[model samples]
Target: MTRPIAGWLSDMDGVLVHENQALPGAAEFIRALRDHGRPFLILTNNSIYTPRDLRARLSATGLDVPEDAIWTSALATAQFLTDQEPGGSAYVIGEAGLTTALDEAGYTLTAAEPDFVVLGETRTYSFEAITQAIRLIQGGARFIATNPDVTGPSADGDLPATGAVAAMITAATRREPYFVGKPNPMMIRSALNRIDAHSETTVMVGDRMDTDVVSGIEAGLRTFLVLTGSTRREDIARFPFRPSEIVDSIADLVDRVGTPA
Candidate 1:
């Protein structure tokens, strides 16, 4: 028989912290996981910041996760492209984080006749850039997107995410880009491989049913939905996907697992 999960794969934004604030019980729950020696990894779709940068930001908010324990779509995208073509070139329509990741992975960043067109979140997503990406894709370049999140949580409220930009490119090119973040099995597989964990022995925790819950289910892991960000109680009924469990916040997770201290 399968045992209760000995590890967890958690979403960063909505499940643990919302914006700059750590959600209720997030810190204590993390402490519990540490005390119990249960392995957990932070899997995030946000590609705007590096894992090290995100670790510092979360630490500043009192959610002490290690730099190496964090995995972002940016990193996964880099790994995927690197593995696909060891010394490939890419035309990136994204921010510093994505560019840095691709650069570190030995990908040449260019705008002309690249091997692939990479889409991620950018503060300055100009029409000119979109046109450029479309031209490249139409000219037979492969397309890859960091994540498929339509909106991102910000202090100013929800803003269009990288997926929105990807949609535009998809519309123009008539070809769907390969997604590398949540709701895609590639990310889960990468995380599991990194941690040396199995799907049956792992749990996925997040806020969104469509992304987090579905991803977990597809990966054959237990899924927990927290009502802290992106997803609300009312939205649960409308979501086509379902989680194995639903809690008010990460704090409630501690109460449920009661992992030995």
Candidate 2:
């Protein structure tokens, strides 16, 4: 028998859960991974919630993911900053997730001659905060954003995300922010490092082609696309790239667990 894949990575939304609802078979897929002792992480571009908070949110959706099994853009950004300049300071424009990650990485949060004006996802964006970020970036602070998602789905409708705000700041300062999330491939690489997973033996499952599939391919992992979220099967032909496998939902993947792609 062929050996099972050594590691797995999945996007949090669409692949596993939609909003507060668990996608069908998400729990089963996670259970299968756990049963086979596969090292895995649920990746997310959202940078507002801590891993513990995300664990609780997932649990509410009927999925039992451990805190250590969650990786967010906030964590990736923090790791990147630590590697670039250990113990540096930043003027942050995010919530607890970003702040906590930066703190744990030994970065002091400050607005006084900060190294970077770090931006992330948040429910509310104050004009004062944006103004400060603009001034900081224009004053020689490097601009860095957690993700480039322009819009996010909300209960009411679509809402402006980090990318939109980043654009505003860019327009004012004429300095573009370095996006550290998916589509850049750095996020995927950092996640693999977090789990000590080899790209050759790791499989990435995500619902979006632009962010998830492209990033996974760039990172040299086997990519699987599901039709439970952002991208539909019809949209597949539009993209220049493609996923290694396509399934209707996470349910179909449950039986394929422990089987090498």
Candidate 3:
């Protein structure tokens, strides 16, 4: 018999909404969680927006996720740094999301002999900023990135993200950054810790096999893959690991929330 799911963690994009629209059944799934008084969180690898900003964006798309219920790569990165080195200084290369999280975590943003060269997602990644990051890493600052997603989707096409820029810095400084986002497992662990939920009774629903499913499995959480995003059913065979359950989308799991799989 499967253990009853007591908590939930889901990916924001692909699983719940895509672009500006909520995926079919996504909103209902969220409502079911609320109705049952279940603990849940919406996780995203994007580090360009704060939770409040993310909540507003989701609301605009008709998904009413609470501000505190959304977690981002920026927050995970900041929390990781705080655990590794409290009150540390960093040379940051990102926008308000990353900077604000670091600031609230009591990390000083600087350029001179900083403790780490923190990289994250940004709408406009400047060449000058990358150059400075290279120099900073070369100057003995450790490299840390919010996530390892190399490219992000845009209306025009795919755009380079933090991972791509982190690769550049690694090539120039010969130092690879420690990514603190999905697929790292540490991010999922941190989220679980924040919710005070045990892995045995929590389910992680995501649209990607590489990041979401892998991280959840490694963290000892039951993993569910939804085909509403980057992954397809056929793609599952390509991965060495598999999710505990597979659903068409969030809609299919609404009725199963209160029951064990």
Candidate 4:
């Protein structure tokens, strides 16, 4: 018999919800994880909202998820900073999620000769903030971003994300910001650490092959791709690597939870 998956890490947007609406079997999947007492985390690259905010949003969509169950890029970035430079100061351009995580990590948010210029997602991108970030980088502050996603989905259309803004900053400062979110595999590793999950017995469920599957593979976890989100079956051929399994949606994974392989 194969080994059973003891812990789970799932992407937030495509796997569980799409445009604020819970995807098929998303609630059931989450419930199954909780009922079975499986360690799991809902991961997201969006750094705009805190876990508390995310829990409320998920609750609004009828998914009963606790705040701690949700992991954000902001959290991962803060953890990375804490490890790299404990209690270091940063000039930040983001919302509460980024700032709060840094604060909890004992990082001071400052603009005076900060250790880093941290960038993250926000509802509105400020030109003033961007300018300050550019100047900071030029002034020798290390450039860091939460994620590398160039665009984000909105009801209207694709909105320019952190990567896009980071590009602008890079053009001005001639320094590329190091992205610490998915595709880095550091984020996944941290999530596993948070839940005391070992890579050998954990599963990473995601929609995008580029970010989810790649990071999972790099982190030494089995990865499952769901079509209910981004990468379609046909799109899989384009990627150099493949997921361990492909399912129609999170619904298909519902019964697999806690089932001994």
Tell me the tens digit of each residue's lDDT in model 2 across 134-226: 999989999999999999888999999999999999999999999999988999999999999998888899999999999999999889899
Residues 1-261 of candidate 1: C-alpha lDDT, one tens digit per residue: 656778888998888887688988989888877777777799888788888889889998898888878988898899999889998999998887798999999999998789999999866788998999999999999999999988876678878888888888888889899999988978887888778898888988998888888988998888889988778888999977788888888887885445421
Residue 53's lDDT within candidate 1 is 88
With a 3 Å backbone cut-off (N, CA, C), the pairs that clash in candidate 3 are none
Error of 1 at 139 (Å): 1.3
- Whole-model Cα lDDT of every candidate shown, in order: 0.86, 0.94, 0.93, 0.94
lDDT at 28 for candidate 3? 90
TM per prediction? 0.92, 0.97, 0.98, 0.98
Tell me the RMSD of model 2 versus the true structure.
Answer: 1.5
How well does candidate 3 score on lDDT at residue 141?
96
Alpha-carbon RMSD, each predicted model: 2.1, 1.5, 0.9, 1.0
Error of 2 at 8 (Å): 0.4
Better of 1 and 3 by TM-score: 3
Model 1 CA lDDT for position 176: 97
**Model 3 superposed RMSD (Cα):** 0.9
- Candidate 3 lDDT at 86 equals 100
Model 2 misplaced regions, further than 4 Å: 1-4
User: Which window of ten consecutive residues has the lowest lDDT sum in model 4?
Assistant: 252-261
